[model samples]
Target: MKHVLLATTGESPQVVTETLFALHQEHQPWPDALYLITTSRGQSKAREGLLERGHLARLCDELGVKQPLFDNSHILVVPDANGVPVDDARSLEDHEALANFIMTQVRNLTADPQQSVHASLAGGRKTMTFYLGYAMSLLGRQQDRLSHVLVSKGYESLADFWYPSQQQGQLHDRQGAPLLTAEGKPLIASAATVTLAPIPFVRHRQSLPAILPQTGESVHFRDVVRLINLGEQPEALRLQIDLAQQLITVSDEESDQRFEFKPSLIGLAFYAMMARATCAEESDLTRPSKKRADTALLKVFLDELMPLCGLQSCADWQTGLKQLLDWSELKGQVKDNTIDALNGGIPDYWFDQRKSELRKLFEQKLPLTVSRWLSPEIIWAEDGALLEQPGSTKGGGYGIPLARKNIEIINC
Candidate 1:
């Protein structure tokens, strides 16, 4: 199997050798090939420090290790929208391009079944390190790894420092001044300390859908990481719908936190109906459908909502049901003459509008952070939706994607 070391670098190219040294000390498998993602300036610095000065070859020779396949060709310079190599990732456009370039490289490398990648985020700008780590999390295989090399404070950022040599070697400062030990002797590379800390991440490459590049469409690296993190979150949360109090409570067993939401009666009813549908094994109920609302279904929903609405009498429930059923008639669009069509029927447009209103109400009542995690469980998209697939159907509807065991209906 081919082992590959993937790293991101900025002006300082010593991270490559530092990481290599740490891995060797830890008795980890050394990479057979090295690939560096950087900007134009970074590429030049790497060439000067590692290749032009023979630091890379010297480190390998001093350590008595086989040199990996790395050269100018292995250095990937991030390009801008115009295909011109970017000098630095200081602008948002540069960062986006850099992210895309990193993702593409990770995807291509992980495509080979026999390849194992070791990603080092010890170099480059902060954004570069972030993007590389995120890309690895997205596409990394079980055999793949992520790490950041840590060098002792004094040895870090030193111009002449590469790897800790076995024999005594001269170490110089940025201005070429000899760095001395406490005894006044010239410091050697062996005095430097290096450690490689492996990073743990949840890989969702297989779970993510194929993201084909579209002309006007783009995927943000952060958005992808957020989604993968959400998917990997343990299903330890449950929602308790207290219809009598017109409140929804989200309980997270893992965090031992509880969030409460007080929505309008209509919003609460709508949410309850969706929750009921999801629990009853009705798939795709969380999605909005163009199909008109069935009168029978509407009647069942109203019946279920009456007790929650605090209707004291049958007459009150009947009046509320009549008001909803008469919406189409009031709009002067009476298509069907049957009692079911007149009393319980609802237009698809009207249903969708009501759902949108309910969603807005719920969102307004819930905390922003909590709402993000709960929106998919509450709001149903009309089109182009990407959410958890607990179940599916040809016709869309509104429902949560949670297991029935996690939902509880209290106080009727």
Candidate 2:
């Protein structure tokens, strides 16, 4: 199997040699090839310090190690959207291109079953290192590795420094001042310390759906990481709606655990309706209904609320429920109609205000974390109106995105 060293670098190309020396001391397998990701300025410095100055070749010769296959072609400069080599990643576009480039390289390397990649993030800007590390986590295989090289203080960022030489040699700082050890002795290149710290990561490519490169869409780093984390959790959540108790029970089937939320009558009605819609695979939950409530849908909402509101056994409950269910009657209340008058006459507007109130009540009743997790799955709105139809809609809405198999609706 071929071993590959994939690294990112900025102005400091010595990181490569330092990393190689540390790996050698640890008796790790040496790479047969070296690939570097950098910027235009970084490319120039690397070529000058490693190739032109013969530091790389000298290190291999002195260490009695075979030189890896690294040359001008092995250096990849991050490019802008216009295909121009980026001088530095200072702009948003440059950063995006850098991410894409790192992801592409990681994907390409992982595609080959015969190769194992060793990624080093010790060299390069913080953003560059972050992108490289994240990309590797996304696509790395079991055999792949990630690491950061640590050089002893005195030798860090020294221009003439490459690795600990076989013979003792004086080290100088960037400004040509002699670097000294803590004992006040001249720093010797041969005695410089280097350590390779391996980074632990969760490789999620196998767990996630295969994302083809040809799609021309780059995956957001955060999204990839979030999905990986979610996969590591116990299991997907299952929801149970109890209309009688005006409660929503969220359970993790794998852990046999549950969380309950008690919402107000209006909130419970809205939530139960959404839960039922999700269970039935209804997608039209975001569509604006005609100004008047659909009688059947109105009944579904009322049925959920009546039990919770203690109106089920009242002699005038039906009359009160009808007035409460009327969107015009509800809307008229916001226009200064007394609560008593709202129970008798209808008006002209929709019942969006009620939906908003329900949303706030439902969210406020749950723990912030649970509310965030459940919000997208159970909320829907269109043209300021709550949607409760049995079909899917393309417009914005809130409701659980779960299938009927995951939801259970009980009368009590």
Candidate 3:
């Protein structure tokens, strides 16, 4: 597996080498790659200290360890919209740009399942540190880790101290005097102690909303934060598939009001799965297959509707629920009415059409956040949106991720 060390650095680029030494002392594998995020002046400082001065190489050579991949590209400098690097983060725009840049990189890195990050939160601006740490908490998995390098007091402020060396080396104090130990011996680089402090962080991926935009799109840090803080969904809303009334009803417990609106037959049929799964806590929700209609496929949809329809008394019904109640003949009649439209016993176009129709209807009628959650487009894997089994097209089939206590399927 590829192990990467991601760190934010400022003028104190020694944080990288110190972090490396700390990891080495803890018996951690040398990272396969190393990345430093910083601003223009910080970039110059890192280039001079670690690259030009050969401090990074010297540390590795003195420690007898191979160096992780490091070069100019590894030092990522935050830049402006015009691609020009800035000296420091003095403006709000610079910090915003810095956040997006850092989070974007972290997102791309953690998206790879084979990679594990050892994020060193030991450097960079206070905002940069916060952004990187937050990014790790949001996107990091179990295998990934977060750490900070803690240098003992004597070495913490020493500009020349990167890591302890095997051989003794001369060093000056802040006063430009020959630094000496308690015994008046010359201060040595090898005498300093660096410790890697592990930071406990919560992984919030499990708590993200089910309606996140489809995967693979670039997600901004602020947008993600906004979604996470979108607050709680209105819980006690009953979604009634009133077959008798030929309309759907949303009951808001807090307001004690009922919202009634009729959807097309196809829309009603598709929503039955979403409403049932959300209210019943069904674990096997899935999207229809793109193939010819079959009894088995039709059964999947019927299974949800049958219980709500109470088919035995459908003789008194005035809606199409009666024909839909007869599961055996339902597939043939549906395929015959909509010839060449069956895909997994469902019309091929109905999936997209019904979702769009439902969205518009609920948006126009209900005018609440519940409308969106009830008919979300994307079925997130960890969002409890669907079962990723042999027949489930995970995202192809949608499920409502609302709490069962918040949802009740009233069959009218």
What is the per-residue lDDT of model 1 for residues 246-265, given as tens digits with 9 covering 90 to 100?
78887666554555777655
Top candidate, metric TM-score? 3
Looking at model 2, residue 1 earns an lDDT score of 91
lDDT of 3 by residue, 257-330 (tens): 56677775456656776766556655444444455434343455555444444444232222333455344365
Q: What is the lDDT of candidate 1?
A: 0.70
Error of 2 at 62 (Å): 1.4
Q: Scored by Cα lDDT, where does model 2 land?
A: 0.69
Full-model lDDT for every candidate: 0.70, 0.69, 0.68
lDDT-better candidate, 1 vs 2? 1
Q: Candidate 3 — which residues are off by over 4 angstroms? A: 80-83, 173-176, 181-185, 209-218, 233-268, 272-412
TM-score of each: 0.55, 0.55, 0.62
Global lDDT of model 3: 0.68
Candidate 2: tens digits of C-alpha lDDT, residues 106-127: 8877778788999999998899
**Shift in Å, residue 391, candidate 3:** 26
In model 1, how large is the Cα lDDT of residue 30?
Answer: 88
Tell me the lDDT of model 2 at 138: 71
Q: Could you tell me which residue pairs clash in candidate 1?
A: 285-397, 285-398, 285-399, 286-399
